[model samples]
Target: MPWEAWPEGGFPRFSEGEREARREKLAALMAENRVDRLVVYGTWGSGDAVHWLSGWPVSREAAAVWAPGEAAKLFVQYRNHVPTARRAVAPEVEVAWGGPWTAEAVGGELLRRGGSGQRVGVVGPLPAPAWNHLAAEVREVVDLTAGYTRLRLVKSPEEVAWLRKGAALTDRAVRGLEANLRPGVSEFELVDAIERAYVPYGGMTHIHYLSVTSPSAPDRCVPSQFPSPRRVRPGDVVTCELSAAYWGYPGQVLRTFVVGTELPTEVRELHRVVEDAFHAAIRALRPGLRAEELGHALEVVRRSGFALCDDLVHGFGGGYLPPVLGAEGFWTLAHASLELQPGMALVVQPNVVTPDERFGVQTGELVVLDHGGPEFVHRYPRGLRLVG
Candidate 1:
């Protein structure tokens, strides 16, 4: 199924087999690099690798120490969090408290496991003190952030299932916003509407950005990173970028809405060009397609004499992977040589705007690449919406 609501008991979790597979992959990478030990760190607001390896969403701080053929030792900070970490981590992992300092705890364990002089592979943003501690114990400390990122590029079946659920919740949130949209509604209230739609089902908010401006005298060309107290007016245009998460996975969708029945001529033209660009990029998406080739799809926007204020496309799910491309003439393309592969998730957002950056419209959603083509993750109704 393309869309799935939260399950009866709670959200589904990755199986033990899945966790082992990820560890095996990481171990293989470590072997290739001749590393003796691997340390995966996780702190509040930044713990993708730790969660992937140990299955414990980081609370304050956490670290997992592993060696070939040995069970991972997970160290969590704040003495009180140990109980939850023990419950959440995989059955094979050994959970412990990091004492007063997590880095020293992990470094002490590394020293005990192999003494000094072993090469260690580090993942995530391990703080400087932790890095120095590890360095003092190991012959060399290698940064394996890129290697970890590469491992996350392709999703397993279980990960894809989680992403599908996230997409459904995200769609529901957008519909919630649309239902409550009307003149005099404050931007903060719009956020409340969105949260109300998915929070009941255990969904968490990843992002809910809003941009409310008068269409006739538009001042904003892109969604604000944070919502404002500005109220929706009769002829106001609202552009939004929302991502509702299921677990750590999230599906992103961008859209524009008008508070009145009629769209301003400039807004209509801009949306038409954006829709064209969205479709063009979707049609060009396929397995084995070079990342730079996808940038060509946005030529229609340039031809229509409209510019873009946001990225035209980017890799999503598991830390914004790669191949972040912008409209041809507007921004530079990164990871241009990358290729789209099956099971990779991407967000194709075409935030079309005028040259003067006065008017704009956002349209797009997350999609997963397949053997044949891209599959839309969201079922939200497409095109510009008219509200009130």
Candidate 2:
């Protein structure tokens, strides 16, 4: 009951009904795909599928076995996390030790649940070694990653609640940046302050704070992980693409700030163009909208005489998922653009760089696609801010 003291009644926690609906959906997907048994496998870095189905945060490695008509069973790497896993997962889910022998543990459970000689499916990107182990016992190994991805494309009520909470913290980080940013303040100091602000919200700041500033050429913005001892001065531009994750769900925002009272005409124009493009993309977000149409929105930046720097939009759930927009020039996990659907969360980062790379404006917000248009999740002001 010690874990019960942690209080799971708030936004990030899910109800039993919500969790059951997810399991039922997974079972239906497996049946449709002719998959007799399905294993949702992942590590801490890629555990969204497992967490989505079982509600347990994977530390090192974990899996959830979905056998049709049987209660889903979760497997964790270490026995020590069993108690915590129990508290994290829904009541009906079964938990077992897995770790060094993950395949064996899951294999035994699947076979016991009528999976012997049945078609097996692996969801998400399971490491080949783990698959080899599972494949040794199970005869047919099918790639059901697409089926799982489709299932996760739409957010559940619980997922939306958690994402909104995470977005609130991301907005708080933006405000924290505004209050602490001043002349002579190192990027390191500002980042530290933002991290502290997330603590009250049960959020953790991403390790890399893209805090970069420019003084001479105030129009340019660049992402930097290594915060230097370099300090801000008057007439400087400070850009931060800050982010935070709450209960494993991540929310991120991009903001550009000027250090001086008078904003330069050149930088102001760049900001105006970027904001206009952002609004256009927002208007384009609706159910049934193809991903490529959203990608075409990137042309707005190019038409405004700016080069596209990042994806026009990217998917987000517990973290960045798939079906990225304007991903033609950038790296993406998806082969083609997917249709926009309600409950899908996105970070619309429309970045524009000058022909000379001397000036740019990058600003965005976490949003959820709705029946109408894009709904703002992180509600901080979208335009460039003048802060001293």
Candidate 3:
């Protein structure tokens, strides 16, 4: 599919073939592990597995049981959610209410499906109570979260198509927030602007973190996970890490903005270093590039006498897959030996802060790893934006 050919005004729907492909891959994984039944669990905060497998973005709590040649059964909590959950899943899936206790209901259903002597593979964040119940019923329960993450590492063409729409919506939100940047606007109002830009087009806000501070007497270094009531002031620096989603896929973009035309020398220098480090990672991105090799980009920040207040790189779009790295000596690295592959989405944000950790700037966005190099998902203009 062409990158920009998705429908304009509603949620993008995956084709039946797409759903079948995912099911096939998952079934193969279960067979390789010698599992007779697979239990996929999800909740409001963490539902990537349920969403990917059944097309339903989980609301409160949900679980599914799948075995070879048998139709998958999806159990959802809160009776009111059953209708929408039924509408969202495939026609073959059986959707039902889990009564008072969702975990116990799933456990009872599993036992009826001949789970007593079978090996079961589990995915998603199943609570301890639920895990204990399933373990007692089944012969053995295998944690398949790692294997599930690997399955999502490489997205399908349809997933990429949806990601493109997500990135476009994210760009719209950031630009909307940029246009509202001026003295006297509260951080909450800024978040309102961001949501207004995309919600009308069915976009959802995954995160809209903002950091407001005066460049001359900067107090905050990184974007706050929650927005404050603090109002913007003349000559203040507004740095943000925003993400807007289309369904479950989201695009992340980090940027720094100055509230006035006069850019502080230190802030300018800091952004320059950030841009350099961002592009350095871009130039080094390729299909076979090692995760640790991307650390070369951090060298630019370290050499410039600045350190990072946030992660420099991470796998994104499909549940923060792997290769979460930070500046050397600043944060611990993970998946250091993982290799980059085509179709993987990643964010290369380099939030460069002073050695004192009092001032910083944000820059970077989501990119897809290609054979040639990293393909930027967002079209938001790079560099320090000036407003007011």
Q: Who is ahead in TM-score, 1 or 3?
A: 3
Per-model TM-score, in order, reads: 0.93, 0.88, 0.94
Q: Which regions in candidate 3 have their CA more than 4 angstroms from the true location?
A: 1-11, 328-334
Weakest ten-residue segment in model 3 by summed lDDT: 1-10
Using alpha carbons, what is the TM-score of model 3? 0.94
* List of clashing residue pairs for candidate 1: none
lDDT of 3 by residue, 1-388 (tens): 2223335533356898998898998998898899988999998878489888877778889999988788889999889999888877777789999889888888888899985898899999999988998899889999988888888887888888788888988998999899999999999999999988887776877888998999889899999988889999999999999888888789989999999879899998999999999989888889988788887888899899999988888888767668888765323343787888999999989999999999899899999887788888899998889887
Q: Model 2, poorest ten-residue lDDT window?
A: 1-10
Q: Cα lDDT of all candidates, in order?
A: 0.87, 0.75, 0.86
Tens-digit lDDT string for candidate 1 (187-255):
999999999998887787889998999977889999998888999999899999999988778988999
Better of 2 and 3 by TM-score: 3
Give candidate 3's whole-model lDDT: 0.86
Instruction: Kindly report which residue stretches of model 1 are placed more than 4 angstroms away from their true locations once superposed.
Output: 1-11, 327-334
Candidate structures ordered by lDDT, highest first: 1, 3, 2
What are the C-alpha RMSDs, in order, of all predicted structures?
2.6, 3.5, 2.8
